[model samples]
Target chain A: MFHRSPIQSFARHGMLVLLCVLAVFPLYWMLNSSLKNESEIFTSSIFPHKPVFSNYTYAFTQMPIVRMAFNSFAVSIMMTMLQLATSLLAAYALVRWRFRGKGVIFAILSLTWLIPFQSIMIPNYVLVNDLGLNDTLLGIVLPFSVSTFAILSLYQSFQSFPGVLIEAAQIDGMSDWSILTRLIIPNTRSTIASLGILQFINAWNEYLWPMLIAKSMNHAPLQIGLRLFVNSDTNMWGSLMAATTVSCVPILLIYLILRRQIVDSFVRFGIK
Target chain B: MSQSLDNTIAPSLSGGTIIVRRRLSKKKLRRFKPYLYLLPAVALLSIWMYRPLLYTFYLAFQKWSMVPGTSPVFVGFDNFEHLFHNKSFIDSIGNTIFYTVGLLPFSILIPMILAVVTDRMESKSKNFYRAMFFIPMILAPVSVSAIWRWLFHPSNGLVNYLLVKLHLIKEPIAYFSDPGFAKWIILLITGWKMIGFSTIMFSAALTSINREYYEAASQDGAGSFRQFVHITIPLLSPMIIFMLTMSILFSSQWTFAYIDMLTTGGPYGSSTNIYYEMYRFAFSSLNAGLSSAAALLFFVVFGLIALGLNMVSRKFAFYDN
Candidate 1:
């Protein structure tokens, strides 16, 4: 493509800058509001007259955000690890083995993808109560242990692995376990990492499930805890904002570090 | 060693006994290996996925208060009749449609333009702008709702402050609390958070489009805008349809969170949608039968819309690869 005239280039640049501002200004306002006092927040000045460090401190004491973050971290980590292991094993079986009813099993698994939380909330609540897993981390992670999308993504990656490599491993007198661990695992690190991060983020941001299961701050994830804060104290905008920022910082950092790999993984997997 | 060889020959009725046993064991293991590998995930799914789904459908026909010592009564079509006759249910359906209509343009069109504009920048700058656009997508939705709720606050909010400073309004406008403005404010916030995902999708779609198309357009004396209209748009139609379908499906889920956080279906049900109403009826009001009936209706309507969209997209979408 040829370059446009200088005036045209300038106009294009101006428009791009405008788009960035539109995308980012509300976030900027959020941070600004968090740092301001009640008077400053009410006044709605672009800059706070007096910056308050107490808001950040107040978030810890007021909302039990630390406990909530810890809970979220524990549940997300558990869910992500479980999802990875289960999805990998399932994908491996589907990819490597041929048997009767394999296609039917895959179809049945994919049907679960259409099953939203709203559809299953009533029965899941009943099941959780009957099992006495309510108000427990196990309850939060159990229902989320396996996702059909994760299994499909990993299955696709495994299918794309070179057949010759697996044959070579077999020729070397390697067992199935050895072939899976040494051959396939090393080759699919990028896909696994991307899926792992995605699963972790999904678990971390989940609200409705945790709200149903978690009885207190002990098991409540960050989303539910943030809701608790806004509901409990109407005057604690500063602390509430601090808590919100704290919950978001980790995922934002992960996105920044893994942007390319994650985007490419989704593109290849064709996941919306 | 000498003694053992003699004993081995004497004990074995058949030669190559070790090899025979090994082959038999391998055959047996191979028969069961796939199932063994799938056992853990299958067990979890049975307990978690299949059981709950079946039980939920069963519970739909029974009236249970979700409390102990309450016997479930079988009420076949009564719940369905009640849900169909309820005015709130109808209004919620309308509200959901209104929000979807309000959001579809901002979610699809604005981000497409942003993606095009951002892609025109140098590669290094394009990466930076891409990151900036995707910041909201990574943030927790609850936090995003809280931030927007504050911004849209009638008094002591930045939006009103800005408007007043610009001399656009003499007084502050109550956004979320006013029934007239509540739904639109929710739509705006939903659109804001969604732009990131849509922009990234479109940006990737744009980049994947071949520059040779542009070269051909330029040779024909077509300007950049004309090339975008004729070449880029046609090439990107598949991605456009894909994202549009996803946005429609996702609109219900995303708005559920916002409605839960900010409005709680307030201002006389202005912010209420089917998703929220279902939650309220099932959980708060303990009307499981009515909620199930509502859920079935929602599924039918949304399912038809999705199927219709899929069929329509087949005609317009161009698969470049």
Candidate 2:
């Protein structure tokens, strides 16, 4: 409640700063190594003695990174839109309408939250392969269309909406569809946006599912593409770093712009 | 004039009928509207998640290579029998536990202390430190692994380079390639990646703690540590439980991407966890039955733990309300 001593304050600040550095140093190293040549990366120096952009050039030429980025963007955007629409509709229903089996539905959705990807992944792979959707972006995006976390968060936001507003609209003979489209969605735009951004970032960074479903660079997102690059060219640390950095740019940029909203959303939803 | 009056009355009467018709349709729609809205999410989840979960159990008892033109033959308990005896599979269970426990310090203790300390700081410094701490949580895990892979490189890695320069070790250690260090390295990297996330959670939890409690505790002659123990700990216990349960449930998954990118569960299966073991069996070994068996086992074990934690949290968690 009160500052007892300057020494205590100094020590606390020092420890905080030190922890911050430790948290960020690996990322800083990735950026640092990306600018160096092959020779410089092998040395013990922290900074590149002579900065070279050749590694980035090499990364561009060696891999279909542009295509991978495009693929990542497309899948992430599509998944975000789809998840939002589904979540919004579901949340609105669960909150607004009283119905039979609502409790069962909620329990089932909650249980789905605990179902790890590993448990369902094998069968999903089989199903995807059977449907002839393997190595397709649709395969990757379809499985993620119903996010329990998104639905839960949206459910909370929708539940917090003023009941009087909905009731008043109902008395005026306004349709449920119009009430949702005009009043509810417009009011909860920020919440929806936050959830959308979180989902987009998640989809963009998705590695395991994409790794399994996407066979080639054409359908692979940035993460899978980066992994393929590393696996095939393990010895090329420079280009690996360059490609890793490139892959992180879009999400990092989005995070920087929406840092507060993104971080706050995570804190609120605890969605990891 | 009489014809005009009749015309107005006819129009009003028709409008009333139209409204009544719409009302009837709306009533019918509203009865099933919730289900209709929930249909898309429910259908997708059933198709992708719930059905696959059931299929996992089914496949666990059958043999199939996921190849077309072949059906899974029922070979009950054989897959489980083999998985139980398999050395790598058994080791992966231990490794997964090791990771979940090892991550507690990063995900719980350090973050708790950091959150409390930062909470006491001025707003400017607090926000600055919070931003810096959260940077890693936003980075993709694949990129995080790539960065750490370079740092953990045997000869040129910053870790070994620093150790040697500081006279800590005469030679660089092939961290990922060595059996002893590989799992620990994975643990370290996973912990590092999680610290920022847990820190933010802790910070949020810490901020929600009523400051008046601390002031009152101080007036009653309690030191900061005492106040934290008497006040903060009780208030934050729910969050702590929540985080611990999450870490236990998802630790294997958090390490999944990293293990794939950096080690591939390498150096004699030392770094492998249950999740990776499942992946290895399914994709690499093409043994769908064995992988399904592993997934089922993982599901039951962690599912029980999750359920247990849920019960514990309900009982022990102190809600301010």
**TM-score of model number 2:** 0.95
Q: Give stretches of model 2 more than 4 Å off.
A: B1-25
Q: Each model: TM-score of chain B?
A: 0.88, 0.92
Best by TM-score: 2
Model 1: per-residue Cα lDDT over B251-313, one tens digit each:
777788888888888788888888888888888999877777676666666667777888979
Error of 1 at B274 (Å): 1.5
lDDT of candidate 2 over B7-102, digit per residue (tens): 555566875766655665667677888999999999999999999999999999999887778889999999999999999999998898899899
**What is candidate 1's CAPRI-style docking category based on DockQ?**
medium
Retained true contacts (fraction), each candidate: 0.56, 0.86
lDDT for each residue of candidate 2 in A1-272, tens digit (9 for 90 to 100): 66558887888778888888898888788888888887788886778899999999999998899999999999999999999999999999999988899999999888876788988998888889889999999999989988989999999988889999999999998988889999899999999988888898888878789889999887899888888887888888988999999998998888888889998888878865
Please give the TM-score that candidate 1 achieves against the real structure: 0.92
Q: Can you tell me the CAPRI class of model 2? A: medium
Instruction: Give the CA lDDT, 0 to 100, for residue A222 in model 2.
Output: 87
Candidate 1 lDDT over A126-221, as tens digits, reads 777888898998888888887777888888889989989989999999999988988899888877888887778778878778887887775688
